[model samples]
Target: MGRAIVATAALSALLAVCGCTVQGTDADGKHHLPVRIELPGAKASPSATASTPGTPSAAPAANVLWSRGDSGSGVRELQARLRQADWLFDGPTGTYDDLTEQAVAGFQGKRGLPKTGETDKVTWQRLVKMTHEPGKWDLYLMGGQPAGAPDPRCLTGRVLCIDKTTRTLRWMIDGRTVSTMSVRFGAQYTPTRDGVFHVYWKARNWVSTLYNSPMPYAMFFSGGQAVHYSYDFSARGYAGGSHGCVNVRDEAAIASLFAQVRTGDKVVVHR
Candidate 1:
C-alpha cells in the first residue's frame, strides 16, 4: 500500500509537468492517468477546454460604435452631447482624441459600464438617452453661429451689436446688418460688461500699455474694454478668453470693420 501511494504521488507530479491530468481509480484500485502527447510542430487549440481555478474570466468583446482616432460630424455631435452632459469641455473639435476618450471612460464608469474609453453601442445608447440632440450652435460653439434675430437694441442705427448669448457681433448700418462674425469674451472674474457703450477710440495698430499686448483694429467702448482682433482667440478658439475685451478671431472681418466703423460708433454688448 505504501509503495503504491509513493508511485501514484510520483506519477501525478510527472503528469503535471508533462501538462496532463491525473484522475480516476483502476479496477484493481491503482491510479489511472491520461497523458496527451503533443506532436512536434503540431498546432494545438488556442483556448483551453475548461477554466482553471483562480483564473480570470475573459472580458466581453466590445460592441464599438466610435472610438479613439475617429473624426467627423459624428464625433463633433458626440462632443456636443458630452458638453450638454457636462462631461466634456474645450471642443467639438470632431476628433476623438485623449480628452474625448477620457470623458467617454468617465461617463461609462459613472453609468456602470466597462471603462474601455470606446464609444460602444451600449454606451452610445445610454448617452443618447441622457443627452438631447445638439443644435447647430452647440456643435459650432467655438466657431461662428448663424445670426439669430437682431436684439431690440441692435435695431435702427450704425451699431456694433454684440450678443453675449450667441457670441456674435453684427455690424449694422442704419438697421441693416452689413457683416457678422464670431466673438469671445473675458473670463468669469474679469467679465465683459453687458450694457450700452460706444467706440470712444479707434486704434488701427495699438498696444496695451498695461498688459503690453498688441491690439489691432481696436475699438475701445468702455474703460480699457475694446472690440479687437485677438491672436489668442484665433489660435486657441473658445478655449481661451480676453482680459475684459471682446475678442474677434477673424482678422479680415475686424480690419474691414475698422475701416467702416468711425470713432463714436454705437457698441451695444447685450445677452
Candidate 2:
C-alpha cells in the first residue's frame, strides 16, 4: 500500500510537471488530467469562436449601404460624405444619379477599395473615418456646379478640349481653360467621335438638317458633329442626347463660347 501510494504520488507529480490541469479522478478513480500542449512561444487559442454565422465581422462592418436608383435622405448623406472628401462636386440632389455613382467610384478608386459605385458598409466606414459629419446645407447642396480637370491637350493654346469621360467642354486658350461648361454627348448607340479636329464652320441659330431640331450656337467639328446648345438637354438635363453632337446644357455658356471660338479653332474630342 505504501509503495502503491508512492507510485501514484510520483505519477501525479510527473503530470503536474507536464503542465496539465488536475481534473481530479474519474468514476474509476483514474486521474482524468487534461493537457493543453503549447509550443514555447505560441499564442493561446481563443476560448470561443470570434465570429459566427450571423455575427457581424470586422470587415464590411455594416450591411445595406447605398447603391444606384436608391433615392432618399440616406443617399443625400452619402453624397455629403463624399463631398467632404472632394470626390463629389455640387450639393446633394437627394438622388443616387449618375453623378453620385461616378463620385462614389472615384472615392473608392482613391481609397484602393473595390471600384463599385455602390456604397457597402465597408465603403461607408472608410469614408466616415476620412470625412467629418455633414451639416444641413452640405447634405442638401441647394445649388452647385460640377466640373472636372481639363485634358492635358486642353492645356495648350487655342484648344476646345472636350472630354467625353467628364462631360465637360473646356475653352482653353494659351494652355489655360478660360471657360468651362458642363456638356453631354451622344448616347451609347451614337457615341461622339473621339479625335482631334478643327471647327470647320459656325452657324448661329442653326437647324439640324437630319433631325430638324434647332441647334443654337453651332460649331461644326467632325462630319455633322457640332458643339451646340440643346434645348431638349436644357429641359431634360442628361436624360437626352444629340444625334452625333456634343450637347451643351448651358445655353448662355455655349453662346458665349460661340463668340470667342473662331471658325478654324482646334476641337479635341477625347475620352
Candidate 3:
C-alpha cells in the first residue's frame, strides 16, 4: 500500500507539471487526464475579443440658407445677383416663386452643385464669390420702386396717374391712392404723349395688328397709345423701350388694374 501511494503521488506530480486534470475513469477503467494547452503569443478569438465603440459620422445634409417660398430683402438680393449673372430675367419681387426656384437650380447646376434648387450655405458662398453686390436699381429692375406723389390733375376723380420722372403708375380714386406699380414709356424718338385723356377702349388678349405683337390687358387712352402689360418689358426691364404705349412689367398687377379700370377713367400721363 505504501508503494502504491508513492506511484499515485508521482503520477499526480507529473500531471500537475503537464497542466492536466483527471476528470474521471473512462469505460476502460483508465483515468482520463485532459491537458489544457496554451500558445505562447496567439491572437484572441473573435468571440473572446473586446468590443470597441463605433466611429462618429458626419451630418446627413448640407446647411440651407434659402429655398423656395422664402422671401424678403434676402431674396431680392439673391435675384439681383442672379440677374447680374444672367440667370434671372424677372423682378426681384421680394417674393420667392417658381421662377426664383428655377433660377436657383440653374445657377447651382452651372456651378457643379447638387442642384437641389435650394440655396445652401456652400452654394451661397460660391455665388457670392462669383457675383458682386447689387445696386438699388438692380434690385428694383423689374419695378416695385416707390411711386411719386399724385399730380393735381389726378386727385379729383378715378385716374391712372402716371409720373414719367418717378417711373411709377398710381391708380387713384377720389384723391386716394388705391394701387401703384412701375411703368416704362416709349423711346426718345416716339415719346409717350403727356396729357390728360380718357380710356376709350379696352381689349383683353389683343394682338397689335400694326406691330404684329401681343399687347395684353390693353386700355387705350389715345388713338394707338395704351396702358398695357408687355412681356418684353417684363423680360428685359428698362433695357428696352416701347413704341408709343406705356409698358407695365408686372403682369399680375396690370391684370388686377385692368379688371378695375373702365372706359372714361381719367388717364393723366405727366413728367
TM-score of 3: 0.60
**Which residue ranges in model 2 land beyond 4 Å of their true spot?**
1-146
Candidate 1 lDDT by residue in tens digits, 68-109: 999989999999999888899767878899999999999999
Q: Please, what are the lDDT tens digits per residue for candidate 2 over residues 140-169?
A: 344223456776776776989888666778
Candidate 3, residue 48: lDDT: 30
How high is the lDDT of residue 65 in model 1? 78
Report how far off residue 63 is in candidate 1 (Å).
11
For residue 54, model 1's alpha carbon misses the true position, in angstroms, by 46
Q: Who is ahead in TM-score, 1 or 2?
A: 1
Provide the clashing-pair count of each candidate structure.
0, 2, 0
Clashing pairs in 3: none
The RMSD of every model to the true structure, in order and in angstroms, is 14.8, 15.3, 17.5
TM-score of each: 0.55, 0.49, 0.60
**Candidate 3 local lDDT, 46-85, one digit each (tens):** 4334243573233233488788889889989988888778
